[model samples]
Target: MRRTKPYFYRLLQLSIPAAMLVLAACSTTPEQTGLEPAQADEPETGLVTIVKPFPENSFHDLLVAEFAIRRQQYDLALQLYMKQAKQTGDLGVIATAARLSQFVNNEAAALQSTAHWLTLKPDAAEAHFIRATALARSRRPLEALQHMEAVIGSDQESNFATLAASALAQSEMDQQAFETAIRDLLERHPDNLNLKTGVALTLQYRNQEEEALRLIREVLTADPSNMHALLIETRVLQQLGRINEAIDRLRFAVDEYPYHKRLRLNLAQLLTRSDIFQAKAQYTVLHNQHPEDDAIRLALALVNREIGDYESAKELLRDLLARSDQRDNAHYFLGRIAEQEEAWDAAMDHYRQVSGGDQLIAALTRLAVLRSEQDGLPQARADLAAARLRFPDQDIQIYLIESDLLFEHRLYKEGFALLSGALKRHPDNTNVLYARSLFSERQKNVALMEQDLRQILSNDPDNATALNALGYSLAILTDRLNEAQTLVSKALKLRPDDPAIQDSYGWIAFRLGDLEVAENYLSRAFSQSKDHEIAAHLGEVLWRLGRREQAISVWQQGLNNKPSSTIIEETLQRLQVNLPDSE
Candidate 1:
């Protein structure tokens, strides 16, 4: 079978003649005439022949048109190509004009040029494809489908199923009508599996998941090794939230076709989310089979990291970093590893090398956090400011990072001013408002704190952070014990496993004089986090209950962990309890 050129390639072929003509014109020389010395007495020929410039030849026009295309002047190129096509009656030229017109969004010109192209070469599949695409662009789906059908009918190897699928994918027709049209087409070719798959995909797009699944299952039953059917079935199951079922199905498929690399890869990737040990085993096998594949190596590294094999993960990531393609991802993951290990310097270096991708913002935030922990607020602020300048779109996150650092250092005025400026720029930003409220609490501006938290709650009534913060503040700083309990209880219900909210609930219970309840919640919170503030609160509750020895032990542990914790210092001072001096 003689293969036909793709639609775009046929259009590109039109430029060849124009390019040749340009070269020919450049190479052509005018006839050289011998000049004779004019006699002085000869009558002066004063007639200045103002030769009106010869109308540009077709070759010159073609040169200018090709140059226009190179300069992205598609409109001008389309005009020139259409004029040349009309003059030359070349089907390739007409197709080029049609495609360029479509490229520039000149629908009318595209239709006219496609008509000329069809007239020139009625059997050309590329011409039909161009006409179909133009019709699709003009929102004439039925006509476009007809032209696409003509294209497929003209070529035995035209991939009719893919063409139909692409047309249906791009169609703007009403869903039921689109499905009806596709079903009608499918009825004509009921035995064509590819067309059946296309219809199933269309059904899936229309949210008819049950029908889509039935068709895909039928396809898979007919040919159990059909990769496309298997992939679609997996996707449908995932959408239905039957992820474990999908994993099991993929695992079965992998067992059936152990040599199928894609099946193995899919099974491995799916396992990464649910069963890290199994995922690690699958990736290790793939790595052994394809040692040079960077993607497989990266996958192995990720699974290793998830399974707590940090040393193996570090080695694989370092090897990937040695290669250029996966360097950014390797650096990002290495930074994560270092951050987890508290290797602040190494983490900062790795994060600094991450220049792009989805990890860029996360890397910058980690850098700010590490700097704040190691060097203090000033350096962290400088690093975050530089990151902001580098990534202007992440202003909201940068503001939060700086404000968090300021708040952690007890620089209340600085934190408040920063959030105030950020709020002025983005007045209704929930995060900025939430952050400013925290600073307000620290500054003892209780009314402002309540106002800011209430504003956040108005926007998002179920904001657990605001609920817990307001509740904890009122419990410790005011006599609204019942209201505090209500808010903290709501927060705990929303986020039962969150240590911070648990601490808030514990503190509220202590204020309500429920020592046993306070002891239970605070003990759970401390067990989860061991945070110094939670420790301080727990020790205070224990001391109030006359468990003086236990309170001293908790405070000593907290002091060992965070020697300068303000809450611990204040609790010891107010309770008049002193740790025994160790010689």
Candidate 2:
């Protein structure tokens, strides 16, 4: 709750143990992940045995070292790793050892050890990959990219090479080289859905959602057995308005990979939004299959929450949280369930024990939203200011939240200013830019708002949020009906069922003099129970359609739902609508 200078400093303490994670994260997650035993226990080769030729048995010792790491015995793991690395003078061993050292919070030691490994291994492909992995985890992307180049240059066929390439593509933004390598690899392994999915994922990071979808579909057509590809495709399809198509793909994946927990979870998520009964059935099946899977329990809790069983959801998360001995993540989910109960104070305390940058940010954002709702704008600003102070250089969505709060308070100018300010700091932040365009239209600043929306689309052509905002604005405010249609159609292609996006098309309908169609979309948006903007737009359309009484009723109800809005005031005055105000 209290803020200090750069709370990301806690990561430094975690970094000591994360050196090990650097090494672990970098290790070759080969096609053959996990030990299914080398064919019916054919002698625990190379591992399990102390090296007879202790001085020169480098590979054997390497396995031994990695084995100790897998066992989670850090101190013993470190000692064995050091011995093997020293005996062989192999730079790969040295680099891996440095990674293990990092796992124990010995960052200086890791840097020292890896530095020596690079010096000796000069040409070792695995060493470069390992070094890059450590550097990237340490938040040094530029340095990580440089080392990734070394890994790619040495050899592109190693198991380690695939991981290095994938990480570089996503984290280092090395798209040209990354796309080239991945596409080439996919050409031969066309049946390998995982490889193709990995390539498609790179497209996502580069802001190429259309291309990403294209790649995903290509893989799905090539081999429907690719469960991971199916799951990702499901998400894209759901976002793009092909909800049934996405759900069908997930259903197929669930059938194909029955034991795959991730596939089951993905299916559950899709069903939760599209079909509550199916979601409940899937959750029930998964819960029965993996009787102890805490995640399944959590997923079921979410289904309950969505279906108006809040008490059940709360009880489930609470039970799951209590039994989760080592599961910190479940605690964070429990906090969300607590939030549904309106137990603000409990949610705050629950979020405290959870770790990681992402979970911390979510907790902070939620806590700030609650404070903003409860105490007022100044207190909310202070909360966000504290978050900014805690994560000075991090991608904190402080501006986005502040703008949302300000928009609610009818401070449209200030709301837009926060987003513009955020764009100054993070020039390519799509969410902030999209929000600015939406709010700009509200303030009637047509030129500047359109410019901002166009900028977002220019940078991210498939930016659904910008497309919806721009189209919706033009429909409601300007006379660019054709342009509005084009933009809204593009947005529909990306996120068809999203209530806000549906609202955009409806607004366009109203502009085209199709009050019936406009009413349909606006009604759908209101049914989703999201924002006040939907209500405001629906009332305007209703007023135009001669549903004067209904229009008056809707506007007054919206104002009651959220009082103090210029839109409400203007609508009421123009209509001479009389209504009672809520206390």
Candidate 3:
């Protein structure tokens, strides 16, 4: 364990509860907010005081709480902070408590606590912002919107207002309200770069993304070094799927501001959505900058795991643990890498150290998958129960993950029953709809699969994967070659040059009995992906076109990549077909 994995941590997937923005109000006293020390530290004020004047705070317990949080131990950290909050009546403590509460899916608790703080200090902008966060987490976007507006109004000049507006603009579901609030702010501060970024963001949220791009471009034209503008442009590029260009732009920006930790981190994240080489390159820079940054180091480990450098990643994480600020994170990440690498015993070793909602939810998910993978369904279920006990709010994901584990284990009836039951209850969930489509596809229930896919497509027209899935399934299942071609073309328009789309196009051509075009498209797709099914289609096309030796070689390569693919057997049968040898 040499400890230096040139990796970055996963960007904070801060649920509504875990966010510091939501917890900001309670993290400091009025004194901490630059108020009079004696007044702010008074333990008997109408408003709560998070940190007393006592020296006890800079002691071991707060450090322990911080350590637990860094290690992703939300439950234990929450317990510690919640106890402190109740005892101290400190808004800062309460805010920290609220932040931890989100990981547990305890939105009701967070709302109550944050709302109480708002009541105590009605004019406190940060308090209102925290309340907004709680409301947003609770899915009360309307209420969140009101409070977000309150936050902006309360602190008309503070950067806090901009940050609050950003959160509100990003999360509010109603396009009109989101846009109007942002427009109002921009009207007030037209030349404010931050507000302009906010307007661009709101425009993007309203799906006028190109307009948002133009706004950012206008800003960047004036100040190319505008970090916020560059960041927004990078995101727009990614959403547009110009991944290469996004990486290129971000890389240039990073070079221009090499010391900006946030810039390098953002670039690394952008790369994760790009090709493996690009992702690795961007991550390497961030990793080198923050050799001690556990987040970056963890990301490097995941990348290593993804690229089959399991031993190296594991060693890096192990070395990192001794030096990591949060030992639990080092262990958890190492465990995750181990789990993916099929080092089950080592994974469990890491998972055992985790107990809070973050760690438990993660551990439970992985252990269930592992147990199910190893013929231990009952144990997997027990792990999931433990997860629910620790983090009760994640009913949907926990159930879906369990069902998926079962499906992967070939327990189709159990998995389908679970998904079907959920669909009956929450029929409008896009994810559930997508999952049901996948289940149908796996069963080779062609009619049902197409029906669900079309349903999903109707609701989410730009669903690239769904479009590709339906197009490919149609090509493989039926002789409606022209329809398959159109569907695939639409998918390609949505996700240009996507490997899966190319594969679908090739497969459709093969189904139409056009061996030459099939060979060309299939060859392109093969270059993009080592997917077995895509290879089988191309191999068969090659064989039919009298390239038997190439077909055999392709099939062999595909089998090496994905031995479980049934299509490999079918491709071998192509050799038995009465096809003439190439001239």
Candidate 4:
């Protein structure tokens, strides 16, 4: 009744404790898990002692609970422990139940057990933290804050901050309530700098960025050297789209605290978007300071590669190769460098050495692509077949790559056949189905395209990609405007921030004769991505609204973004709109 399904999923996110194996060892004492058995009843006969079992906290219950735990039946174990806690009023049992409940995300159970725990040990910070977690999860943020305050009073401020972070990820209403509760607490602790920062954090989560910035400035005013406040101010400034201000703040912070690793790392990452040279300089300092840090070294290597300093990148990558954990990544990047310099043999050698890790598939794909160009398509296909046999887990991805290669060579029939075979081997695989659907569209097989997209929707009704695809296809290629509108509307609700889905929604609105709504949605989608198709749709809407000059300007901008966009060209042709050639 309390939606235990989501809690079960949350439980699965955690690694199962290795201690559960001890349940089967017979050496584990009942006190360890707090499901202690009742003492055996003995008859008064001096010669022979006959043992009797009691119903409450019986030995039988202990064995069953331990067996359940060994079998990974955590819910059963939790139930047994909860029952024992209630019957015996053992603090240990209550504590175990509380922790287990929280682990499994059973908010109600956690609250009840933590209440019992608090009753026995009123000063336990763990109990307050656990209770606060359950209360926050249950949308009782005010009550949760009280327990969080109690946790802080017990010098568990770190734990309270962790709870607050988790609370921020809750629903919008919950986030508002959490922010409001933090503000109320800040009122009580007016001079508490941590409280001020906490309010600023919650306000940022609630999207009150201006207010959050003001609060952080207040903290900075009180303590100019507050690193935490400085970090929060940078984040708030970034959220408010004032990246330069954020960069300046970080620059000042790094100047003030040159030894701060996080401050410099943040500065380096921020600079990567706007000023690559500045980013490289910051990363250089970070790398020099932390020579043993592989992540910093990798970042510096990437920065070097981006700046065309191939020799420096190669040196850093070679250094990373000494660490077994980073070997595959190192080989992958080295291969990329070789490819960039047109050293095909060296690139292939490096890629071949990437035997495992996250880069394995990428290396294999690149190796096959290069092989196809240098050797024949037959040899490349054979190599892909060998890769499938060697890495069966990557067979589907390998097949997709093969199809891409075939399509790139204009072998449409071969590519379609490859995807069809893949679909036979992996029926109802959404990725394969989606790929096949795109191919079907290219072949003008509208029915097949609809079928594949519909199959994806049937398997996963909330799949926004399939929804938008099917809806847009209907709007463009069929006379099903109403159906297209409905599908696209659902997708927009599911992924409101997705530019592709927004474009689909606008396209459907245009077909359904809602010009103003279409304009608004298309403008928003284009503003987010400047994507060619969205630009085409938006320009047409503007043209229809009798704003021909505005329409041409939008079209020109789209062309500047992507000169090879056939969609924009076709739209212009269809509308008989002639544009002057760019100077």
Candidate 5:
């Protein structure tokens, strides 16, 4: 009367005996046979046919489910498994359903399956853990915490701190809520070192450094050999900007735990940042101990490169390139080494192998330079165009590099045209504007130069390079002495130790007839940089002050440094001093 047609239809669909379905629905425990408890009292009715009908549709569904699993259709498999779990009341099927649901990221179905599993096996730690994880991800922290407590109580394999930390890490709660929850747990489990560590980690994540450090120290005090506590302490020290202290702590920890690779690796990395020699020593020992470890070998090679031991670095990189994992990086470093040695062919070969990562652009730029050196400007320009086509997002950098090549070769018109075209595409780009201004200076287009530099200043008032360039141009070529003085002074204040700015200040003083001031500034600039232009300026100042011998000595040194310095030659000829013969 209550509609047995749906039940008949389901039984037909499942192809199971009606009596077996009834037995499955009524079974209370996994060991229950086909007989329901109510039926067991009176049923010796000898219903062998009821027990014998094969679940053909369910068996076929299971086969289809396995096929789906083999094909990596986990979602469809999860649905079939969950249906089987509900029909059979089988613990194994329910657990599989829950696990498969989790695998497919079907949180709602996972929670449902895990809830049923827990109902069947109330004391199952794995079921509690799965439910807790699902609940936490679903943002039901309170329910998750209850199940987490049960998991901690039942699971003796992992400590309370570790489980709690794992839960906290996976929670979506905000910092304050996380801290509050963790603190509450800590109050309940005060002696749980793992839980304490978990709380400290949460605090650290929130940047509550002082509290985190205190808790980590407390844990270390209780268990001095605790590697986790020590690592946390080192991290806290680093966050406080006490890198040296962090290094010392790691060094001591490594000595105590001599075989602990992580501790030693941390010490080595910190040493690399502060003292390369010490880093190299540590890495050498590590490399000797772990000859099969490519990371250790790579670290040693990089340290060698940093210390200018290019031969050793090249040998290490060559050995590493024999393996496939670090081929690109090895090629990049090899290219750099070859470039240092001025072996253009060798450098290009290595750079061409470097096809990806952070060094790709740098390698390409170096390759272009080498091509220009070996072939010609036209080849370099063509290569740069190809590079731009290959890496369209890096158009700005390619344009800058090509323009720099032209400028260095004294092809002013070509450089200007390239920069003008780039500006048309990227009109507000500061680098292009700055480069164009420099090209205008070479062309002696003072108005264009001033306009470009002022445009830069309008956007970024503190651009020291533009300020110095503008000021120096006005001091040398125009009568805006006071304005030039102000601009150069501002630039000097912004970059107090810049030698170029010092030279500009000196040049301004010389133009204003302050010979002593000019000499002092020029001497400072020349002493700091040893630049040919600074040397020329100093010599001119000295010659004007009747110190002709000193001026000649300075000019000679400048000529030795830069054999073809036009500024030094012109100053010597203008002052009626004899120019030295070419060396």
Candidate 6:
């Protein structure tokens, strides 16, 4: 019995016809084109260039393959090309097959095709890069690194950043293979700045901030003017909770390398967290230096808006509308500005123009909200339904938005009906399931909430959100203290620093009669976030521990944080305690 290999990676849409045409055109040999004999000897001297041409006899199959691609039958196209490659032993056909297989995420076929391509053109940088990427994605880290090494000094070196990102993602899951592979690669290329920085980036992601910072400092010591090293060091410092130090580092780096766009942009972004005025000044400098760059202009506009310089922001946004690529972003920001100014008509007009780009969903949601206020909920919902048809890819988001609108209007039944319909259309979608679970909790349907959350957990057992939600719900709504403790403990282990998870853990501890443990966890959680829910928990735990004045102060702080917080009100009411309202 022959075993079939499953395809890996998500299937990308068919969008490589231009690339296919380039591959076909590059099939002509130097000899056939009457070029210099020295040019033809490039392959023998470890400088392999063009792929071998397809034989004339295989033209009919090639045409059929091209037709299959036109029909969006990528699998059929790849199969036909692979067959032609095997029959003719042609590098061109093998390269085509490899690319097609990779595009369709048929990693097994890609490996086979790339092996054949490499056999025919051993020094081909493109072939090596593709093979390394596939091997990395397949978790064959050692093999991937070997191929990656082949392309290090070649033109394909820049592409290694993508593979490094993949390695970092794997590292987050604590994959030993990638960790070993990076160490081995570093040992082989110890002095390579790119490799060192890439490894440091992975270390930074893994929360080994001290080690990551040390590596980045080594790079900076060797090349003090290195922009990448400076940026990475800032990130490491930021991760270590030294935001002011990070800002100061970027500020100094900016003074030294004033013309570097990325360095200045990063500095400006970092400054926004602490000093909006300073961030605006930096953006203004960047904008003046590169007036033609839409991204810089957009950043400057956003900073101006952040400083409440609405007129300046509007001017920059309106200017950006002249550029086709920035039009959607400009319209979206303009709509937001109008909304801030309470100019509903202008806001709707600008939102209407935002038909595409990342801001489309947000713009549509805001438009629906305004329409609901001006017209009616039904009209707003009808508009969203039309938007769902217009952007089928955002159907789930539209559905959720409509559900929120329903719940906002106290129409719980309509909200549930909408969620049920969404679940039918997108069966077992974890996001939809999670949303419905929260809605179910709102309606006090604990059984329904458990069913939905359990469905999500069954599919993704390590989902921290579902685990925490379920555990907290069980602790508050039912008497399953042991199970709640188990679930919440698991969630806390997964995300130990998360305030919400810590709050849940504290609540469970309090329920289990561990008041001291509850007080410690809840105090730390409230200190970290100052969230109303955490404050409520902390206040109750303090009250029970005979810290009455502290409990009142915590409850008052909670009310001051959010006067509309039902959590704080309910906690105080349940404990039969009354404090003066926050001024």
Candidate with top TM-score is: 6
Query: Mind giving the per-residue lDDT tens digits that candidate 5 earns over 264-309?
Result: 8888998988999999988988898889999899889999999999
Off by more than 4 A, model 2: 1-292, 297-342, 351-362, 391-394, 461-464, 474-583
**What TM-score number comes out for model 5?**
0.57
Residues 69-140, candidate 1, lDDT per residue (tens digit)?
A: 667776788788789778766444565576577667687887898788677667766657667666766766
Model 1 has a clash total of: 0
lDDT per residue for candidate 6 within 300-401, as digits (tens), equals: 899888778899999999999999999999999999999999999999999989979999989988999999998888889999999999999989888888
Better of 4 and 5 by TM-score: 4
Question: All candidates' lDDT scores?
Answer: 0.74, 0.64, 0.65, 0.78, 0.75, 0.78
Give the alpha carbon lDDT tens digit for every residue of 1-583 in model 3: 0000000122112222333333333346532322111112322223333433423542344456656766877677767766666666666656556645644656676676667666667776665655665666654544565565565544333232243344444434464665676677667656665556667865665567788898878778887777877887877877787778877887787777887888888877766765655667767777888887777877777777678787867776787677636566667777887766678988876876665535555666676767766757887777776665666676567766776676567676666677787678677666666666666666777887788778878898887777777877776667766887888888888877777788788778777777788788889888888778777888888878888778777777777798776667755664564224323
Candidate 4, residues 1-583, lDDT tens digits: the string is: 0000100232211111433332223222112443211111221111111122234333345456656755778798788878876875656557767767876778989999989888878887777877887886775666777777776544444233444566676787767777777877878878777667878887776688999999889989999998878988999999999999999999988998999999999999999999999999999999999999999999999999999999999999999998998999999999999999999989988998887899998998899988988888998899888888998998888888887788667676777788899888999888888877767766767899899989999999999888888888878888898998898889889989888888888878888889999999989998898877888999999999999898998999989899987889999999998998888
Q: Is candidate 2 or candidate 3 better by lDDT?
A: 3
Q: After superposition, how far is residue 99 of candidate 5 from its true place, in Å?
A: 18
lDDT (C-alpha) at residue 193 in model 3? 59
- Local error of candidate 6 at 48, Å? 14
Q: Please give, for residues 1-583, the per-residue lDDT of candidate 2 as tens digits.
A: 0000111111111111233333332322111112211112221122221223333344454445555555666666667667766665544445546656655755455566667766765665554555555565564444554455564434332222234334543434455565566666667566555555766766655556677799888987887676656666776676677889878877877787787878887788777777897898889788888978776877787778778787877777777666645245556666777787778777766765554444666666676677776677698788777667766764436666667678667788887777777788888666666677767777899998889879888998897777777787777678999899898888878976778787778878877888999899888877775355667778889988888778767777677677775667776677776666444
Cα lDDT of model 3 overall? Answer: 0.65
Point out where model 5 deviates above 4 Å.
1-253, 259-278, 288-296, 305-312, 319-326, 340-342, 523-528, 542-564, 576-583
Better of 1 and 4 by TM-score: 4
RMSD after Cα superposition, model 2? 11.3
Per-candidate TM equals: 0.57, 0.49, 0.51, 0.69, 0.57, 0.75
- For candidate 6, the TM-score is 0.75
